[model samples]
Target: MSHLNVNFLGIPMASPVIGASGTVGFGLELADYVDLKKVGALSGKGLAPTPWMGNNGVRIAETTSGMLNCIGLENPGAPYFLEHYLPEVKKLPTIFIANMVGKSVEEYAECAAMLTVPGISALEVNISCPNVKVGGAAFGTNPKQAAAVTKAVKDASSLPVIVKLSPNVTDIVSIAKAVEDAGADAISLINTLLGISIDIRTRKPILGNITGGLSGPAIKPVALRMVWQVSKAVHIPVCGLGGVMTGTDVVEFMMAGASTVQVGTANLADPSAMGRIVNELDEWCDKNNVRDVNEIVGTLKA
Candidate 1:
């Protein structure tokens, strides 16, 4: 067997596979299907300072090799999570990261401050959210706005901050650099790509929000390219996500420069996906004579 342990953003993880936000649902939901201890970490669903009802109507639509969702970041609010979920989260052996989302910079800071309690290891700030104060444009699309949000959360929380970046932008490196310069401890990318599915017969959009974030196997190439680019541009560790499915996929991302990887859409297909991917990664390392998984990080040949 090979060593799969990793120290990501100062948090010691047994593996490098983290449960992507919005897909894992607080980590406890998959307890029956997976041994959560084997996984590196779990990023709970995106939480706001207050509860959000999320989108209505058809919120999800299937695509060729992926899915589209406009779930609208619905959650029971941070107070509820801290009161009802934190106790259970503390019981889990692995690290628990709170994924924060907000409509404004202050809201993001507020959410970060609220989740600074025990049991949560870090904060993954979702900059993909719209900045309602800025005409509803996504904060991740603008370099300055992304930095402002990063700075706000960094000042608000004592825990490490990992700003999650959106892939809808033209120059992802600029946004990554901005967040890093603003004191982000680490970074995770690329958040789901903006996409839409159509109901051909109905002659209308398929999702309730008319468009949604796309994820799954189809985005893997684009994700790897971005990860390779941003990792080279920023000094902080990069946690890659998008279309990671199997153990080999994890290795690919690591070689492209991700220190750790997150499994999103795959978990929806197989609840035990993270655990299985961990085992597969171990097997690959052993077969390839790789002693430690970290050795492969950013080892990509020109």
Candidate 2:
């Protein structure tokens, strides 16, 4: 049998596939269609200090190959998560990584400080969420701010810190280095580039927020490039995610410098996509006569 097992950011994953934040809706929701334990890990929707109702009407808008999201981080807030979701999800066999965002450095550190549970595997500092009106991208777009927030969260948490990065920046590698210097155990990118589409007739945008982060097949190439750039820029593990849909996409990410890849919009098309991708990964590696999966991680072909 092909080896599909791997370790991601110090957490032992059953495989190399993980569900991106906001796609799985807090693990408990996706427990019916697929077994959460089979996945590499689960990153919940970006959580904030307070619960968000999200933007008004029409949270999702379709594009040529991908989609735009105006979901605005509509989560149950930190207190609710620590009280309601965390305790219950901790029992599941899957690795639990909380995806978090902050309006201020202190706020980011505060949430990290409070999460003292042994069940959660790590802290994913989401400095790149484009679905909100505050803090996520602003902190991520600048290399300096990214480092500051990363260090803040690192100082507060005992769990390994994985900084989620934004693709809307000038130089992604610079930002990658910044976070690594701040003590990120691993880095994940690129979180949906800022994009928008207008309603032709009304001359208004399709999403209520007028703009959103685009994710799906359309952004895969760009993501692969960034992952390749950032992985070489820092020694930390890079978890690449953009428009990953199949085994080929996963392999591409691995070769381009991803230690792991997260499947996002693909899940919206098919819930069992992650499982199928894992199966395909084994066959692909076996056919190529690859002995160890990690051999290809960050081994970009010239």
Candidate 3:
């Protein structure tokens, strides 16, 4: 039998396939489509200190191979999540990771500070949101800020913290190492690359915010490259995301050094994508005579 059990920052997952933040929305929406408990874990939507109305309309636009989103990280603030959503999400059988962000470094620490209360399995510090006006780039684009933000959250929260990395930087590996040195338990990288799409007919942007993050098959190559480089650069576990659509894709990420892989746009294409991918991974592992999935980590000979 395939040993599907995997540990990310000490959180045990039945498999390494987690539902990416913003896509899974706290694990409630997909309960009707598939039993979320069967997957590895669920990363909740971006949570701020206060509820946000998010960006204007035209928030989502479909491209030939991908999608642009200007959702602006719209979400109910942190306190409400701890009081309400956490209770509901806690009832589920899967591991729960709170993905959070804010305008300043203190906000990120504050959001993570109280995560030890209950219902949250771990904290995924969201430093990669490109649509926001402040801290997204503040923490992600620069190595010093990234490490400083990670240190703040790590000092505030007892819960394991995973700093999500942005791809819109010069040296992603440097930022990854910074987070590791700052005491982040793990790192999740390749958050949607900053991008925009314009409608030539109207000569206006397709997304409501005029600019958004690009996700889907278009980002796979870039994501894989970063994951490969960052994995080798740091000692902490790396969770990879970006354009993963098949069991083969997850395997590639794992081989390239992803301790776990999260599904974002792929889940948007099919709500049951995580479940199907889990099943596919199981079959592949069995056929290949692989025992522990960890055996594949950092095996990318290329």
Candidate 4:
């Protein structure tokens, strides 16, 4: 098999495929089904400064090619994770990235600081959370707010920060550049697009939150476009994710300028998705005569 290793934000990964946050459940949950060493990295579910109950009603609903979720970033608070999950996570052979979520700039920074332990390789900051100080506007929808949150996290945590940008923005490049300029070590784009699904029989929204983030093959095209655009605009590495399911999808994202890609909903569909994707990616590289996966980054042609 061709070399599938990659360096993401200065951390060496066995493969370019990482388990997306909110799907992998702290990295160890898939231990029984997946050979953790074969996968690149595992991004734990999103964690806040305090525990979150998530949504009340239906938290998930299946769509045509994807699914909608309003899980509300549910997770045990950062303190609990550090005390309980981090110990076992440190023993894993692969890299571990902590996903941090917050309702305010301070909460984000606090969570970042709290998770800055010896085990974690980096912090993936989810700026999609509603900024309570700004009337519930998502922090990622505004370039300035995104930059502010990036700066705050940078100030609090010594770990490399990867700001996950929301796809609901008008100009994704602006938001990407803003975080890069504000000292973000890297950026992950196209966090699930905002969507809604309604139950025709009941005449009510399928998700308790009414609207939820959509993820699956349906959003792949939009994700590739944004990753290509942002990679061209910023010097920092772009981690592309939205509807990645197979090795071909991983290759497509990397060609469009993503240094790494995260597998989200695919994990929900298959417990061993990341490992299978890594194998497929290796096969693709070997068949294509590509020696290193890095050779394909930003290789997209006009």
Clash count per candidate: 0, 0, 1, 0
Please report how far candidate 2 places residue 71 from its true position, in Å.
1.0
Write one digit per residue (lDDT tens) for candidate 3, span 61-130. Answer: 8986899998988998988888877778888889889899877777777877756667788889888644
Cα lDDT of all candidates, in order?
Answer: 0.95, 0.85, 0.86, 0.93
The count of backbone overlaps in candidate 4 is 0
* lDDT head-to-head 2 vs 4, winner: 4
Please give the lDDT score for candidate 1.
Answer: 0.95
Model 3's C-alpha root-mean-square deviation from the true structure amounts to 1.8
lDDT of 2 by residue, 129-205 (tens): 43234433488888878898899898988999999998888788899999999899999998998999999999898
Quote the lDDT for 90 in model 3: 81
Off by over 4 Å in 4: none
Cα lDDT of model 4 overall?
0.93
Per-prediction TM-score: 0.99, 0.94, 0.95, 0.99
Residue pairs that clash (backbone atoms under 3 angstroms), model 4? none
Look at candidate 1 and tell me the lDDT of residue 199. Answer: 92
- Candidates 1 and 3 compared: the better one by lDDT is 1
Model 2 clashes, total count: 0
Clashing pairs in 2: none
Order the candidates by lDDT, highest first: 1, 4, 3, 2
Cα lDDT tens digits for candidate 4, 1-302:
43888888789888899999999998888998888888889989999999998889898999989999998888899999999989999998899999999999999999999999899999999999999999989999999999999999999989999999999988999999999999999999889999999889999998989999999999999999999999999999999998999999999999999999999999999998888998889999989999999999999996
